[model samples]
Target: MVRADARENRARILEVARQALAEDGGTSMNQIAQRAGVGPGTLYRNYPTREALVLAVYQLDLDRLIDAVPAYLESHPPVEALRGWTTELVDAMRRKHGLGDALSPGLHQSITERSYGPVIGAITRLLDAGKAAGAIRPDADPRDFLQLTGALWRAAALPEDRSQPMLDLILDGLTAGTGRRTP
Candidate 1:
């Protein structure tokens, strides 16, 4: 077990790393250490590499996304809950693009698959609820919806400005036509 001070230092390092990565695309270890008021060695001791730090930041964001789901569902209609979650996901993807740009593609893929499971599960529950309530088509597969949303993020990450219109189009498709599930 880590000492209380060590745990505190680790938490502070992660927080500073996340802030730095968000504000500056390619966050340097020295910069993160400076922001956390820690020495470079301390940052390295806590997180051995830049990829580790990036993965930690992604996991932190994923935790927030997972925790928000139940609250969103309780407070909003099924369709509204799904929409709110999608919006949050888009914002997360924007942040992810910044962080992943600095890391290896393999590392990014591994981290995303590991950290995104809970997020996907939350979305699945929301989609299932929406379909059951007849707010969404019963034939709508949650996985397909998620894949489409991810595609939107990828499109938004493009050099061009396609996010808004693409998101609008996706939202329209999600709610297109009647709620009837074709036999």
Candidate 2:
């Protein structure tokens, strides 16, 4: 069992690295360790490689996003909850894409592969809620929704950031024939 101090150190390091990498993807490990108030050895012991750190940060973000499904569903209507969730998801995706240079191609592929199932499960839960509430079409599929969300973050990378309106269109399509389109 990990001690409390070690857990705190790891959490602090991940938090610091998440913020630093958001501001500057090329930030060095020494810089992160300094900002995190941990020694270089501590940082290296926690994350043996820069790529490992980057992957952990991405995984942390995805885990939060996935865990948020239940809370979002409880707090908002299905379609609106989905909107809020998708917005955060797009932002996380953009950050991960920004850090693409920090990850090796193989590690990138591995992370995506490992993350896909959970992400789809999150989408499935959201879609299932909407379907049960009669807010989404019966034909809606989590895989297709995820595919379209890929376009969202990609379009978001462009100067225009048209992802919101694009998402509105997508969500509208999902709610079509269900009589749940917002007035």
**Each candidate's root-mean-square deviation in Å?**
2.8, 3.2
User: Can you write out model 1's per-residue Cα lDDT over 1-183, one digit (the tens) per residue?
Assistant: 889999999889988888888888676899999989999999998789888888888888888888998898999998888888888887787788877456689887887788666777887888788877777766666677777777777776789957667767766666676565458
- Cα deviation of 136, candidate 2, in Å: 0.2
Q: Which stretches of candidate 1 lie over 4 Å from their true place?
A: 1-4, 154-165, 177-183
Best by lDDT: 2
- Write the residue-wise lDDT of candidate 2 on 1-183 in tens digits: 999999999999999999998888889999999999999999999999998899899899999999999999999999999999999989988888887557688877988898899999999999999999999998888999988999999999999889999999999899989643467
**In candidate 2, residue 124 scores what lDDT?**
92
Q: For this target, which candidate reaches the highest TM-score against the unseen true structure? A: 2
Clashing pairs in 1: none
Candidate 2 residue-wise lDDT at 156: 95
lDDT for 94 (candidate 1): 76
